[model samples]
Target: MSAAAQRVDTGRAAHGALARQLRLARQGRSMLFPFIGRSRRFEIWAHYPRHDAVDSSGRWQFYFHVHDRAEKDSARHPQEHGHIHLFRRSPQGKLTHFAGLALDARGLPLCWFATNQWVTGERWADAASLVRELAHFELRLRGPLSGAGLWLGDMVRFYATPLRQMLEQRDAALERHCRRHDQTRAQAWADRRVAVWSSLPVNWPQDALSAAGPLTQ
Candidate 1:
């Protein structure tokens, strides 16, 4: 098969896998809230429900949290339950930002997006490089939330094209921002207003679920 075919295959496989992960978790009655834990539910200014929880292997790391409700910004970032920031580190390596996905109260994905360097405090990776990594992601996380981990990484492939589009747009947004201020690319990458860039409305898993599932436990 050609490389293009291979990428399509990988993306199709990832979509199916992610959808199944959600289904199984729903069957287990764990769904989405389990990761948040009960203790930190309403704590203000907290990383939600707590900190960046890493998988047992310490490779896949993520956290779900929200901005201060009073904090105003673009309408694109409407206040929601919160958003989860995703990251991955290969064996014996350090974590790199994956992308951010916003979730609604029903636990459905609302959008796929990115933020400024200041937002995630994550190591920088350019668009082309990140796009190359997207289709190759195959996270085999351990234990009960194992599927969730795989789902997170695979979701990138499942949404590979848009993910790449997001990366390109992120860079473009930064470029336009830097041009506007006559700042270098590196300087504009840190701009707060240009922080959230490259977003697309949520799609996929819901369609997959409809075709292959009944989401209730």
Candidate 2:
């Protein structure tokens, strides 16, 4: 086979493997969630897309929705299609960790990414706690379900620390950036976020989706 043909063959084989794993992940009989629980210390929830939970902010918000539905259109595909979002809440009723599984058409996770939006409080203590728990959010892949799990694990290991650092760095940079650009507006926004977080109800949901349920449209 030509080099191009060989490359295509390899890609097809990988895709097939991913499809098989996604099916395994979707199987109702698997005790994967319990196994995942043993590897990590956080409550995990897995389910198909809930149209009711879709965010009005489109794909930019917490929820995931496919942007492109074409069969061979990965280039222009949505940010997160066939994947699950993991939420880690602190014992103090604050959302401290957030991760997502970005899956391919076969529902096999291919990449992992972390976000900085989880840290919204002015109190460094709260932000610090969220970051600490995020370090241990592992996504394990074993046997036929290894594709998504391995990808998730890699994402947790690679991006978790970097995302936290970036969030801190971004916060500091935003302070400076805003001061240089529009100090008053930036200060007001910061103050509002601090106040909002400080005044959050003591019983706030530990998960973002649950917390956002009331506000979800």
Candidate 3:
């Protein structure tokens, strides 16, 4: 009934429609990642229908590179502590915009802004309701859709540990950064940030979907 609720509903509806289309398009599919070698190198990839793109059929897909242990350790600058990259392509195979997720050292998403010639930002909690919405969308593609399961599996393998480490390190770094910046205010600021993040609704509309069944039907 509220504006925030409306936005969430819209996102759910959009995702549901996209999922059905994916099911139909990929019905006989067995493996989403046919490419060989280090599939783990590429995690969290999915194709979704999008109207904004030049192509109408919505073949656009995005991939996320949460963290590359090898590259992150080797890179000279390492501007990204850990990030998600999104890519899209037209049905004709023309490249579209590439986006990124920028998180602080603690892995909490920041505001959506652009970086490195790519769009980057935190997920909108107000609009999305739950962090898992993003994860679920990725998983759904792997689930009912078949063949795409590898994407979800690879995502879990590649990101699970690194993401956990990123969050832990981020929290530690914030605590340290705050203490160094101002010992007297560090605890208060950290507490406030934690409270704010915790207070934000982090559960998806699982109950609604469970009661209503798959939105695609």
- Number of the predicted model whose TM-score against the real structure is largest: 1
Residues forming the 10-long window of minimal summed lDDT in candidate 2 = 196-205
lDDT (tens digit, per residue) of candidate 1 on 1-217 = 4777866655465556556655755566333554554554466556643655676756667767766667776734563557778876667666667788877655566788887776766677788877776656666655545666666665666677778888899889888877888998667767666667677777646644543344342
Candidate 2 lDDT tens digits, 1-217: 4656544443443343334334555664222332242233422232322221222212111223343345443322253344444455334544322544455544434444332342233223334555664434443333433443443343344344444664454346545645765665336445423221111111101222231222211
Model 3 lDDT-worst window of ten: 195-204
lDDT for position 203 in model 1: 60
Q: What does the lDDT read for residue 81 in candidate 1? A: 59
- RMSD from true fold, candidate 3: 13.3
What's the TM-score of each model vs. the native? 0.77, 0.35, 0.27
lDDT by residue for model 3 (63-114), tens: 4334454642332123434443333444556543222344334333332221
* CA displacement after TM-score superposition, residue 133 of candidate 3 (Å): 18
lDDT of 1 at 40: 41
Clashing pairs in 1: none
Which portions of model 2 show Cα errors greater than 4 Å? 1-83, 108-127, 138-155, 158-161, 169-173, 180-217
lDDT of each: 0.66, 0.37, 0.33
Which residues of candidate 1, in runs, are more than 4 Å off?
Answer: 1-30, 38-41, 48-51, 55-59, 90-95, 204-206, 209-217
